[model samples]
Target chain A: MQRTPFYQKHLDAGAKMVDFAGWEMPIHYGSQLQEHKQVRSDAGMFDVSHMVVLDLQGAEAKPYLLKLLANNVDKLKESGKALYSCMLNEQGGVIDDLIVYYLSDTAYRIVVNAGTREKDLAWMRQQLQGFDATLTERSDLAMLAVQGPNARAKVFSLMPADEIAIAELLKPFYGAQIGSWFIARTGYTGEDGFEMMFPAEQAEKVWDALVGAGIPPIGLGARDTLRLEAGMNLYGTDMDETTSALTSGLGWTIAWEPANRDFIGRQALEAEKAVGVQQKFVGLVLEGKGVLRSHMKVTCEAGEGEITSGTFSPSLGLAIALARVPVACGEQCSIEIRGKLYPAKVVKPVFVRQGQSVLS
Target chain B: MSNVPANLKYADSHEWILDQGDGTVTIGITDHAQALLGDLVFVELPEVGAQLTAGDECGVVESVKAASDIYAPVSGEVIEINHALEDSPELVNSDPYAAGWIFKLKLDSTAELTGLLTANAYSELVAAEA
Candidate 1:
């Protein structure tokens, strides 16, 4: 299994290591519950070095991205602006969901999932036939996400004086270069924080500084629960290459306006939209005993569906899930667990945001 | 180091059986088992008066990581179950030996006791696995 630059730090901190997408990653420092609560309550840091970062440079970079991603890249007018989009196949199926940063007129940075790196790269390369953009995967950089309510404050405390001003001025979904690092005011946990990418060799030094600043080191186990609570869709579990963004609660990422923008998968999405989407992604809260689990059956008056991702929310102290159900499904359904059906309340996919419950 | 009380009898599957000395015994998962499973989010216990045999899957413990079956160490009928686990499964992580006990089984025969390992033997087993 591959190990990140901070592997030794994780080992020294007594992390429970597990194999995640071929990487020997920390599942938890000790107690996953404690780590999750720490992120929700105060501040926590995650070593996300396994995620691949690719830099696209050339005069045609903007046009290349426009044809490649489902979301319109033209919306990124300001430098350092980030756009969350899905690279789709001709069938409108999501190849991968990613965040692209508009660094400059001819350069952009894209962060893709670790597991889908090779496939995503191959797809991007295949689509680069007519485009003049060059894609370079930056394996030399390590990524860290500092999250939760006090995450920014704790990170600022450790930043150099000159970088602090730039970091403080960064708006949501925007990034800026600070010193030798690129810090983005974006996160997966629906919390206020920055995802910083820097030279891999400096990972330990930065990690130690964050730890000294009282930012607890969290692992992938809590990271999953935190993102789930925030209603963020995991790449594989929530949606994969066979799933479309329309049915995966990501329709908002699709740009349908300016009808003349002939992006890949536009025809299929338009066709699907015309035919009407049959399945809708919805959030579920278990009203009865039992924890919701992925692949579990969900039944309602309209039809049956399956849970895409499920977990016990640490903040809500209840089992919650994201399920793809028939569009006619009502606000109440039942989830099958261990051969028994338990009632569940259907709600919007987002359960929490900004460290507070958004569910009614 | 995982805690293994010297007085309790252990099963190879990591369940602990405490003989109450009244033909009834309390059963629960070991600290090692709970630790491996991470935080327990839910637990399903067998109903009272349910007949169970040795090695039979009598209950389930679901943690955030995965779900595992809790087997009956020795065959008997369940006399009582820890209903409190329905709302607070973390008790298994907090106190696996005492308050987290899953059920009280009325043993069919005391002769089954000899099949279980002593605390020292169980400690060796856990150490070997680690």
Candidate 2:
């Protein structure tokens, strides 16, 4: 398995390493529950260097992105602005969900999920045939997400004198290139923090500095729970090549306006919408005993469905999940677990955000 | 390394059985098993009056990572279960050998205890898997 630049740091911290997307990454240092609570309550850092970072440049970069992503890139009017979008196939199936940062008119930074790196690159390269844009994977960089309610303040305390001011002024969903570092006020966990992308060689030093500053290192196990609690869709678990963005609780990310802008999956998505979507993705909270798990059958008034991603929410101290049920399944459903059906309440996909429960 | 108390008997499936001297015995998963499961959030225990055969699936331990079935190591009648796990499942991770014991069973036959592996044999079993 491949190792990230911070592999030694993870080992030194007593992390239990596991194979994730062909990379040997930390699952947890010791207690996954503690690491999860730390991120929700305080600051925690994650080694996210395994994610693929590509720099797209040349004059046609903007236009290329416009046609490449389902969401319109034209909305990113200012440099440093970021947009969450899904790269879909011709049939409206999501290829991968990604974040694209507008750096300049001719340059943009795109980060895609690690597991889909190879295919995403291949797809993007194939589409670059006539366009002048050049997509270069930045293997020379490392990414770290420092997240929590106090994440931003803690990260700023470690910034060098010259970059500290710029880092402080960065707005949410914006990134700034300061010296050799690209610090973005964004994160997978629903908290205020920076996704620091910097030179790969400086990874260990950066990790040490953060540790010295008392930011606990978090692992992928907590990362999953954090995102799930925030109602974020995990690329492979929540949606894949066979699933459409419309059915993945990501319909809002699609830019339906300016109907003339024909993106890759526009025709198929419009057709699916015209026919009336059969399945709708929503959040589920188990009202009874036992933890909800993936692939569990969900029966509702409309029909039966299956859970995409499910786990015990440490924040709410209950089992919560993301499921795709028949569109007409109202607010009540029963989930089958171990041959028994348990009642569950269907709610908006978001169960928690900003360290607080948003459920009604 | 996992704790394998010399006095407690073990099952190949990772359940540790402690003979309470009386007709009943207490059982729970081993330390290694709990570690492998990570932090447990919920546990489904068998009812007190339920009768279970050897190797029967009687309960489940659900951690954040995955859910694992708890099997009956020996034929027995369930006499008691740890109710604390329903609200605080982490007790299994924190004290697997003591307060974390899952259920008490009235052994169908004391001969079943001799069929279980000794602490030394259980240690070897875990080491081999590692």
Candidate 2, residues B1-130, lDDT tens digits: the string is 7888999999999999999888788999999999999999999999999999989999999999899999999999999999999888899999999989999999999999999999999999999999
Chain A vs. true chain A, TM-score per model, equals 0.99, 0.99
lDDT of 1 by residue, A82-149 (tens): 99999999999989999999988799999999999889999999999888889999999999999999
I-RMSD for candidate 2: 0.9
TM-score of each: 0.98, 0.99
Off by over 4 Å in 1: none
lDDT of 2 by residue, A317-355 (tens): 989999999999899999999898999999999998999
For all the predictions, what are the DockQ values?
A: 0.81, 0.85
Identify the runs in model 2 with alpha carbons over 4 angstroms from their true place.
none
| TM-score of chain A as modeled in candidate 1 | 0.99
Clash tally for model 1: 0
Clash-forming residue pairs, model 2: none
